[model samples]
Target: MGAETNGNLEFLSKIPEIKFTKLFINGEFVDSVSGKTFETIDPRTGEVIAGVAEGDKEDVDLAVKAARHAFDHGPWPRLPGTARRKILLKFADLIDEHAEELAALESIDAGKLFGWGKAVEIPGTAENVRYYAGAADKIHGETLKMSSAHQGYTLREPIGVVGHIIPWNFPSTMFLLKVSPALAAGCTMVVKPAEQTPLNALYFAHLAKLAGIPDGVLNVITGYGTTAGAAISSHMDIDKISFTGSTEVGRLILQAAATSNLKAVTLELGGKSPLIIFDDADVDQAAELALLGNLFNKGEICVAASRVFVQEGIYDQLVKKLAEKAKTWTVGDPFDPKVDKEQYDKVLSYIEHGKREGATLLTGGKPCGAKGYFIEPTVFTDVKDNMMIAKDEIFGPVMSLMKFKTVEEAIQRANATRYGLAAGVLTKDINVANTVSRSIRAGTIWINTYFAFDKDAPFGGYKMSGFGRDLGAQGLEQYLQVKSVVTPIYNSPWL
Candidate 1:
């Protein structure tokens, strides 16, 4: 529901409509080289929210040139660690100050609930900035033990100009994830956000300027992947490319990068994660978590537990209870304060596909309404591990519940898919938890709780889900290069 513009809430609700035309380049707003622009439509209302700059190869070259210049000869990379940290801290504070406006833009543009955008995504972005800001001052080199008559050490230095391409599902958060660490590591970057959700990113560039970030240190370009994205990936000036999107696109980026400088790449791609529920687990709690795991963010998340592997002993009971609970989840306008219409029609379409694909939908295989993208939260029972619904990464609010006889079968079925982003297990037995957790090949595993995260935890995947982490110290290391410094104490006799 849109907030009221009266009484105590007037100031909070009086967000002015933003009209963005030009992209942010070299610390200023400028149009594309071709003078091209595209309309960013709101998924909820199917209305053109704003016309964004349509950047192509030439624009990408300009942005990358600026960023490369900044990284090679500008003060951004040469700044002391404390100075960089101070600037990042100020950026985070500015984000906090404009939290409401950013959240509103994200909610309207991305079809996410305003409450979630305000309460979780915006604050999380600020925390990520602050986290990396603090980490900026702590990056250091190590002294090595030398066997020869030479002083040996190592340097962890910035990888130079980086190209960051973010996804649409979590625009603000992913922007911070890719940009914060790169900036903190002293690598100037040119960011290409998903065309579906480009507004928040442009707004972020505005905030960076407000925080006193230097020109060419951070830039935002808006355009399709074929043109703008290809140029950024294939640019010789870029030293590294950090992308968060589908696996298919990541492969293209890798190929393009290879064609040029073979830049270091960090990709956080797709997943068809699993949630296993054992016989001894709390059935009610497990069912609730199952629903939440698949329904959170309208199941638009990359690590959403699309497949649920339940033990045979309690499979039927859990399925029935989960179906009843799924019915209670309201689907309506995302702006509606009382409803959770986040995924709506997009989710419903997946539900229809499940039925048409002969997945034997046990419950919730229909649309909740004719208006909005509202799909009934659906679950399938007679699902096999090899089914399309189970194997594919359906980015919607649908879960395929399958049964397994033992832990070995569960693990076999869970790891059968190429994805290994995240998995959840529900069991009271510590040994069982430990065994199952170690056996499942996901990047992150939960014992009883599902969809949990920490800023310090390393998150990524094995297999086709893609690699490289997004948070923690390990995440920061992805943007850095390790250089070994060697100097001889005395001239070699051979020389």
Candidate 2:
């Protein structure tokens, strides 16, 4: 491999030893009930990294039983919030201590940039956990002024056993996004990571054990989404399910949860978000934001700003800069393959659609290198709002550029999609920023910045992007159920 690199991308070379591949249940790594195993492939080289245990309905049931017991009879749910906080802080420290190994595993397993994982994401994950750990000791419900002749106060209690179905795009990020908050709320869980990437989740379970998290408090199941994911969703014992994935699969989970014990559900689904660049914006900064917004993480993110609406005044200049950036955008994977071939093929098909649909190919509308699922960073101009390239959630490094005459028009065009996960606005006019940001139907609208996700701020989507928040105090609420108790005022209402 060469030492070539791109901005903020350090091409580190290291093959992490695959230590844990079995399903983690009841504080121990164990084989599946059926003794079935599936080969986990390294996307960089398309080679088998390890034969992970294939957890199915039986495995999920066992995990759920453990989680249920943990919640009902064990100490996790019954433990003081301060105690939970202490243990979770230890877990966060463990994560930080092993940052390098986890980053290497994540980069190889998910085809992510190694440097970003090590320097940015890994540390960010530990911080997120710490944030939640701090919040654990602060969970409390407020007193309610009742209308009746009674005094009332509420108790915010852990909902119960949770089923976390996380995606492959941001494996550890999504894991902590769900797990940290739930743990802070004193909830036990059964986790099913994306089959495409499950190594870190297992490692996390190991860390949990070392952190003094009790047996059956946190379990990780590794297998395909259909068998293991569905089992977790439909398990009668699970009190809630938090999922991050496609809207299509989110629908399935909703159905499964509804038909089971009617568990509470939180879904962070798909998006076809937009990034608007007005005429007054700096062309260079706008171009950088657009490229980074759509191309970061190989465009596998749900909130990728694939739709770029540039005001006609600076459209041409921004387009020129974007073209140059697209050309220089590094396309390489650690150890070997850098992207999932399944998504790689899908991204190529979208590129062809851009051509056939009459969108002008500005730069990078083709594959790169001789081997693996590597595609050039693609950008298209003269794109119509109704075109497939502009309308669909392609989930790739493909950007669709369109010209808009007015802020109203930009807002309307941006809100055209069924998805409303996130959007980006680039403008110097405060009025324009306020107007367009308020008018957009998306859950998050980034002004002058993109991908500004944080642990303190809540994150989720509107419309097809799904419901419920994943960060902040709001994130912890998703795993808690409120119970109100009232007492008649000194025998005034004895009748």
Query: What is the Cα-based lDDT of residue 134 in candidate 1?
Result: 94
TM-score of each: 0.94, 0.96
For candidate 1, the TM-score is 0.94
Candidate that scores best on lDDT: 2
- Cα lDDT tens digits, model 2, 284-380, are 8999999999898888899999999999999888888987888788777653323567887888999999899899999987887666677888899
- lDDT (10s digit) by residue, model 1, range 1-495: 444434326533634488565788888899999998998766655667788899999888889888988888899888888999999999999998988788888876787777677788799999999999998888899998887777889999999999999988888999998899899999999999988788999989998988888999999999999999998999988899999888899899989988888789988889999999999988899899999999888778988888999999999899889978888887765556111244454456566666777788877767655544546677888887777788888787789988899989988888888888999999999998999899988899988998789889998988888888989999899999999999987775633
Show pairs that collide, candidate 1: 1-335, 1-336, 1-337, 344-373, 344-374, 345-373, 345-374
lDDT of 2: 0.89
Q: Model 1 lDDT vs. the true structure?
A: 0.85
